[model samples]
Target: MPDAVVSGTVYDGYGREAGGGLVLEGGVLARVLPRGYSGEADVSGAFIVPGLVDVHCHGGGGASFPDDVDPRSIRKAIGAHRASGTTALLASLVSMADPLPAIRALVPFCESGELAGIHMEGPYVSPHKAGAQNPAAIRGADPEELAAWLEEGKGFVKTMTIAPEADHAMEAVRILLAHGAKPSWGHTAASGETAAQALEATSRCAAELGFEGVPQTVTHLFNAMPPIDHREPGPVREFLAAARKGRAIVETIGDGVHLAPALVEDIHEWAGANAAFVTDAMAAAGMPEGRYALGGLDVDVREGAARLAGRETIAGGCSRLSDQLALFARRGALPFGQIVRACVAVPARAASIERAKGVTLDFEPGKRPNFVVFDRGFSPVCVVRE
Candidate 1:
């Protein structure tokens, strides 16, 4: 029996959009009805899509996850993203001298379901490509430190970004996989050959642990890494090649600042389902442009772009996933379905939190009612979660 119904242009998890109505019973989708079906709510002309899942996000609503130890401040950030239609997300912590305190502080949220998991974006990255990361806190890969952080997380640590060329990088990958966390490569100065070797080694480790289907990711591809030149291809080429082969997922900040629209389109065309969209947002997201903090670094947000206080390096993103989705929809550079897949499906799969948490990316029967409604302009009208 249907307790409620929402009719509109519905987008399924696999990027298929059509005019239909979703029947809800007991807080789960009971059935998907055809177009023009009478329902409790007739949201005609609105777009209905799965609740967004952001795999990489630092903070929002004036709170910095890497700097805040208070649960109130952390919840504020989570609320900000949730209001913007990101129902699932990973709280990202940047490189700091000691990450254990923050890791312990965030574990409760994970347990309480406020956050899907915690992503440590490293004290084990390259200094040259540190970008907004505090170089002083960056260190060589240490398996012991990684193990301690994972232990404190209590199975809530989802991913960690490490440079492929960092010392003991392979060991760090093994440790992350052993603890049920995925490793993402970024903030590196590794050559193409070194990047390829790292991917091969990571695949071998995952296979040994019976986790071969779970793919490693590349952190915000092309940012915090060397550019691709015809003569010197760098790691970007290797990462994209792996993505094409379905061996890895590449994250792209489609906020129109981290990457150009044309480049975003190109990568989406090349990587398809392997490309995941993320905000990489910070404390300034959903807040007015002003001063903010990411980890230990001071940042200034102006014109919707967050940057280091006095430097040109981009600190983090200010736009939410909804904002990015709107931008892509307006541009029409890629199909609307493709954009949604990158925003919702791919990221959820990358984090491997959908099935584990009973969160489905599609409006399937017996699945939790997690979705968002948007107007013609792509502004979020309402968010629903079971």
Candidate 2:
């Protein structure tokens, strides 16, 4: 196929180049051309980067991933986020009554590539730190049950969130490692030392099982985990230190509602390349302010924040990656390249779904042509898909 060109200040997903145009032949990137080049399409001053990857998102539009079993509903959720510039994402399922039924139902979606994979966010998490997760569904880690879920997923399940402080934590980590799944620690009350020990054990198991490129990460750090204290630092401090050393990745709900702007900036400075930005959005993402469902829990979206109905605990985000990026862009605290790296490269790498048409989270020549074009305000003008 002949190349179709889209010109702009091209960001190759890691850094910006002088080239202001990108050529797409079919869905693969064909060329990175300099300024003043002519192409099939042109948006000369727009910002261009690879399609954003969301590793941790519940649902969007009016479709809830955990509640809707119909394929059409699942497709609706997928379509909702895709329209907003997320080319790839995992369908996050929270704790529920017998989560396996829902897991089995969603297997086909992942197998067919409607979703990047299934992110099982619960049933094995800590009851103490269960934020929006249903406490009734929380339980101790069971390697046998974990193996069963993996088997049912048929390689469609990419990641699982486990509370590292739970009983049989090491064994659960080993189970996940053996079955080619990454364990993301969250929803815990573990001390820093305990968190470090659990992650170390997982690393050792990965090595013994010949697994590579699998690193430990925390799920929505500081939300489901204890706060950092000078006298009683918890997973937050440990995860930050590990992130700084490139030993781990930390997922942050960068939307200002979940974290302060200054704290978000601190994560960017502290974690550097290991910082991954996620929406953790629910069914209200593209919808107007109203009531919604997130894994069977009632949620209310008010002025951009989704919270439990009549409760103080946050349900999830109603904003998409574009909204989160705009917050950072508006603050002017970080470089453009850094923000794109957090949204695309880092999260994709952490979730193990980075491989896309001969390139992973990048917009270079020979890579898959999936990206979003934004105007000066960072609003998504258009999403280009192969």
Candidate 3:
């Protein structure tokens, strides 16, 4: 393969994903090599973060990717996400009564790489934390039905958000894990202790990625369940306290709203680069803030934030991973390197695809960065690259 090198300041350090002079022999990174090598391309002041992953997304741009949405519309939505540098994405699908028809219909396309994976965001959540998901679309989790998704969706199903405290949720979690789908607890009124129990239960169901087995996740951080009371410390708070037995774990949405900049800083200090930054984006992302539909529910976007119409609950974010990184960088909330690592390494770990990621390199303090060429600084630069 011919070598093509792109060089800049290496910001990300996970999955061996470096950002300086990434030596691409074909599309795979050959190495994070010396500067001014024969095939190197230089980009000064640029930072490299992962091509973002959107695990929770509905529509972006002016289109929706749901099965009911048109083919052309889906393409448009995906294109919008691509513009923002999202290389991996999960279709955070909303429910339509029973979701099987749409899942089956979209399977061929998704299997054929129309989407990275599917995240069933609703139809099994608390009505209170349902947010913008259609209550009409909500259903009680049937272990049998979840098993069908595990059977049919297969590798294309990355995650399924369920109300852990709800009926049959643990059974569904077991079935989902049996079929290689990761289970994330969400949209429940689970108390703090219950949340910890739920996490332990899911851990029992899924094989712990780390040596120590633990459910190892809490979706949307401060979003569903209860608020952190000094005495009670709700599900979100308890999940935030996940650290034990050398286990590398903890998840958070870095939309700034999901966890404030200060909270993000706190997480980085505690978890290092292991903390995840998910968009949890909805149809309003990459598009103007206004009215839209998320999972068959009415949503309104005001000031670029989507919320359930006529309610205080947030539906999802209206931004991309790039936007989150930009915000994090601008705020200087955490060390730039750590921020980049969270964006790159954590998401890749979540998807279990660290091997195929960008460039990889190890460095000593004296050495300059190994691989660093991404449009972390300029929008126009990214546009030009394509």
Best by lDDT: 1
Scored by lDDT, model 3 comes in at 0.63
Q: Which candidate is the best by TM-score?
A: 1
Model 2 C-alpha lDDT per residue in residues 310-349, reported as the tens digit of each score: 9989988887887888789878999888998888888877
Model 2 residue 298 lDDT score: 94
| Candidate 3 lDDT, 90-168, residue by residue in tens | 6678755767765665566576665667777767888877766677777778887777765777567767777767777
Least accurate 10 contiguous residues by lDDT in model 3:
377-386
Lowest lDDT 10-residue stretch of candidate 2: 355-364
Query: What is the per-residue lDDT of model 1 for residues 240-265, given as tens digits with 9 covering 90 to 100?
Result: 99999989999999998999988999
- For each candidate in turn, give its C-alpha RMSD to the true structure in angstroms: 1.8, 2.1, 4.7
- For model 2, the stretches where C-alpha displacement exceeds 4 angstroms are 1-3, 16-18, 26-28, 35-40, 43-45, 356-360, 364-367
Give the whole-model CA lDDT for all candidates, comma-separated: 0.88, 0.82, 0.63
Regarding TM-score, does 2 or 3 come out ahead? 2
Q: Would you estimate the TM-scores of all the predictions?
A: 0.96, 0.94, 0.84
